[model samples]
Target: MDKRRIGEFEVSAIGLGCMSLSHAYGAPPPRDQAERVLKGALDEGYTFLDTAAVYGLGHNETLVGEVLGDRRGDYVLASKCGLSRGTERELNGHPDILKATCEESLRRLNTEVIDLYYLHRWDRRVPIEDSVGALAELVAQGKIKAIGLSEVSAPTLRRAHATHPIAALQTEYSPWTRNPEIAVLDACRELGVAFVAFSPVGRGFLAGGVRDPAKLEPGDFRSGMPRFQGEAFEANLKLLEALEALATEAACTPAQLCLAWLLQKDPIIVPIPGTARPKHMRENAGAAAVRLTDDIIRRIDEQVNETTVTGSRYAPAMQASVDTERTPAEAAA
Candidate 1:
């Protein structure tokens, strides 16, 4: 994998998201399997790992900590705070919560400092500056090496950046999820902030690996996602056919083709594709080596433009939380 600069730190261009090692995607992988996958990722040249305090309620971070153990310094550790889960999901950007969360993340991650710490979501109840100010304090104290924000609008990012330098901004950006191009991508480029793309494979949908949603286990996160449900699932599969055809022409897996498309779109963008299986991990990492030509990138963009995709990225309720600033009413109908 190639190395990319996230602020002052150099990390793998194709990072690994450890969320599936704990929860969301499906059943958690066995401890031995998860550990092996983590170790294998580092062995294969992946130097960036992403997790969060809320992912499996911190189980994911603890797993990474236990697996990586004394080798923490070998990779750039990135995690998120702000989004909290109690009776329901809550976005808490209060300074006190930020401080408390960082302390807990440090303990669970078994790291003295995090390379990059992100606010998982924008807390509507608090100003973004307040949250970012608290994160800046952590940087001053050397608890966090850099600051980042997730799922935030361009304006919100600018406000937060004014409080402190945001090293990166993470958002769902793939052929199926192109909303970031509206403003987020341009803002990141304008501000010289790196853009980390999570779900760059559309949560594995664009890979042609997911043929039937019914095969997904109960409680799988995809069960709740709009694009993976009923008619929407069938509609979206048609779009994947075009992507798969292109992948064949590129002599790469559908997943790799999706990632290659993103790489060609922006030099500052890095896609973190997660996997609990070692083979899948290696396959995803190989995408960085797949050189996409200008013609290929343009064909991809022309085929995957808004008219081709069939469903919204998130469910109606979850969509409201995205920092797009549009009212739910406007987004729904």
Candidate 2:
């Protein structure tokens, strides 16, 4: 795997997201199997691991800690906090709650200091400065090595950076979901912050594993997402056909094609693709080796841009919380 710089630390260009091993995709994999997948990733030279406190409600961190115990320094461990899930699945990011949450994450992760700590979501009630300021304190105390923000807009990113140097910004950025190009990616480039693309394969949909949305379990999170619904799902599958052709030509899987496309987009962009199966894990890791020619990249851009993917990335309520660009009057009000 290739290595890239995220602030001061060097990490694999393709990192493993440990979320699916615990939650979000489907039933949890057995602990031993999940640990094997993690170990395999490290053995294959994936030195960057991403997890969050709320992923399986801290169970994910515990699993990572158990697998990497005592050998933590061998990898760059990145975990997130700040989003509090209440009884009805309400997620909040208040500053005080973030402080308490980070402490809890430290306990669960069993680490003296987290390599990269992030605010999972922006709390509407608290200013971005306050939330980032609290994270700065954690850095001051040696609790965290660097700071990150997730699912935030350019304006909010600038405000948070004024408080401290943010190492990276985590968000969904795939061929199917290209909204970051509107502002977020440009802002990160200007500010010299790394852009971490989560779900770089479009939540496995772009990998050709998800041919039918109806095959998803009833309570699966993707079932509630718009892109996985009836007409939209069918329409999006057509888009994948173009990707499948390119993958075939490239002698790679669709998942790898998608990952390689993102790698070609920006050298600073690191993708954290998640999977619990060892075969899929190895396949994802192999994406770094699939080089894309300039013509292939241009073809991909043209094909993906021509197809209009249906549905919003976030549901209605969650969409309201994303701190996108709003006028000063709207922000103050």
For model 1, the stretches where C-alpha displacement exceeds 4 angstroms are 85-89, 325-332
On TM-score, the candidate that comes out on top is 1
Give the Cα-based TM-score of candidate 1 against the true structure. Answer: 0.96
Candidate 2, residues 245-285, lDDT tens digits: the string is: 99999999999999999998998899999998999999999
In angstroms, what RMSD does candidate 2 have relative to the true structure?
3.5
How would you encode candidate 1's per-residue C-alpha lDDT over 275-318 as one tens digit per residue?
88899999999999999778778888888755577667777788
Instruction: Write down the TM-score of every candidate.
Output: 0.96, 0.94
- lDDT per prediction? 0.87, 0.85
**Model 2: residue 230 alpha-carbon error in angstroms:** 0.6
* Native-to-model Cα distance after best TM-score fit, residue 67 in candidate 1, in Å: 0.6
Model 2, position 6: C-alpha lDDT score: 89
